[model samples]
Target: MIQVRGIHKSFGEQHVLRGIDVDFHEGQCNLIIGLSGSGKTVLLKSVLGLHSVDQGTISFDGRVLGDMGKKEVKVLRQEMGMVFQGSALFNSLTIAENVRLPLDFFGDMTEAEKDERVRFCLERVRIDPESFSKTPAELSGGMQKRVAIARAIVLNPKYLFCDEPNSGLDPETAIVIDQLIHEITHEFGMTTVINTHDMNSVLEIGDHVILMEKGVKAWEGTMEEVMDSDDSAVVEYVFRSNLFKKLRAALKKA
Candidate 1:
């Protein structure tokens, strides 16, 4: 599990995160949802160690990130995986090659072992062997995202972080990706953190949801609790969609 305690961060004169405290449990899809400038990105980056917090501690399991040595930090990073918003696969590399890149860089495996691991990851993400040699440009958006996911899990990481994972996909494709992430999180028992504003994803797979407003954690709960919540911030943020408003009304009637 990942724990954030009273973490604060600022950039120049702009304060991004303010005393944000939350726990992201293992084997669950913990979602950080908010508007464009709601500090969601900053909080995610802070947890990923891309940005330093001004106060408080971010811990993986029980080890505080602020106290880890460089070597220790490196080891921790090796156990973490990230999927970017753009499905950041290289256009020049084939699907298999992209998935193998992490293994190539950090793995001590022999050539045969590397090949087996790469094949296993690709297959785990449901990518066919036929497309393994194709470049990212040749595949559809959904396929590219799957390839990205394959790369993220190639190392069998303990922590998985996704930034706007469903971005740019059609609704149906988005749902498929959401379900894929959900399944992988439980299957691998990884602590998965996803930063997204997609309401559908929030309702569909948000095992733990943290709603951010301004720079603070406005609310935290499961999806079912979100449906019943009367917190103004939760209501204002969630009911922005007419569909959800109607759903809430139906739930109330029922």
Candidate 2:
């Protein structure tokens, strides 16, 4: 599990995250949802150590992150996997090469070992190793995202952080991607954190949904509890629309 205790962060004059506290449990899809510039992204980066926290503590399974030495920090970083927005695949590299990149740079595996690991990861993401011959440009956006996921897990990291995993995809494709991620998170008991504005994903896969408003944690709950929440800010952020109304109405039992 990942825990944030009174974490505070700011950028110059902008106090982006204010005393944020939350826990992202392992084997679950923890969602950080908020409006643009509401500090959700900053909070995610803070947890990942991409940004320094002004005040607070972040721990992964009781291991404090703030006081790690250089070598210890490097080891901690090795245990993390990240999928940035836009898939972040190298344009010049083939899909297999991209997936193998992490193994080459970090894992002390022989060539044959690396190939087996790469193939295993690709198959887990529902991609054939034969398809690895193609570059990122040759695949569709959804395929690229799948490739990115494959790469993210190729090293079998313990924690996975995804920013906008379903971005730039059609609705059906987005659902597929969400399911794929949910499966992997559950299967490996990975401590997963996802930053997204996609409410559909929140409803579909969120084990814990944290609502952020103006740099503070406004609310948090599971999907079922979220559907019953009366907080206007959370409702407005997640369910205030004709479409969401239709969806909720459809979910009502006879």
Candidate 3:
């Protein structure tokens, strides 16, 4: 589990995060949702130790991030996996090579061991062996995203971070990716934190949801609680979707 307590961050005159406190549980998809410039991204980065918080504590399990030394921080980072919004794969590298990159950088494994691990990760993401040699440009957006996921998990990380993992994909494909992330989180018992504005993903796999607004945590709850929430920020954000609005109305009638 990851815990944040009274975390505050500012960029010169622009304050991005204000006294944010939340817990991302292990073996669950903990989602951060907010509008543009709402501090969700900053909060995610802060948790990942990419940005320093001026006043607060972030703890992974029982270890506080601020108290860790350089070597300790490096070890902590090695245990994390990140999937970017754009499925940031190197176009010049083949799928297998991309998945093997992390292993090359961090693993002490022999060549054969690395090859076996790469193959296992790609297969886990449902990528065929025949396509392993293809570059990112040769695959569709969905396939590229799968390759990114395969790379993220190549090290068998303890924490998985995804920034809009479903971005740019069609709704069906997005749902598939969402389910895939959800399954992997539970399957590996990893602490998964996702920064996304996709409402469908919120309703589908938000085991724990934190709603941010104007640099503060406005609300937090589970998926079912979100459906029933009357908090102004939660209601406003969720009902913005016609589908959710209609679903809420149907539930009211039922």
Q: Considering every candidate listed, which one attains the maximal lDDT?
A: 1
Question: What is the RMSD, in Å, between candidate 3 and the native fold over all Cα?
Answer: 1.0
* Global fold similarity of model 3 (TM-score): 0.97
Better of 1 and 3 by lDDT: 1
lDDT of 2 at 136: 95
Candidate 1 TM-score to native: 0.97
Clashing pairs in 1: none
Clashes of 1: 0
Q: Which stretches of candidate 1 lie over 4 Å from their true place?
A: none
Q: Residue 111 of model 2: what lDDT?
A: 99
How many steric clashes between backbone atoms does each model show? Answer: 0, 0, 0
lDDT of 1 by residue, 1-254 (tens): 99999999999999999899999999999999999999999999999999999999999999899999999999999899999999999988999999999999998899999999999988888899999999999999888998999999988999999999999999999999999999999999999999998999999999999999999999999999999999999999999889999999999899
The sequence of per-residue lDDT tens digits that candidate 2 reaches over residues 1-254 is 89999998988999999999899988899999989999988999899999999999999888899988888888888888888889999988999999999999999999999999999998899987678899999999999999999999988888999999998999999999999999999998898899999999998999999999999999999988887777888778777778876767677642
Report, for every candidate in turn, its global Cα lDDT versus the true structure.
Answer: 0.95, 0.90, 0.94
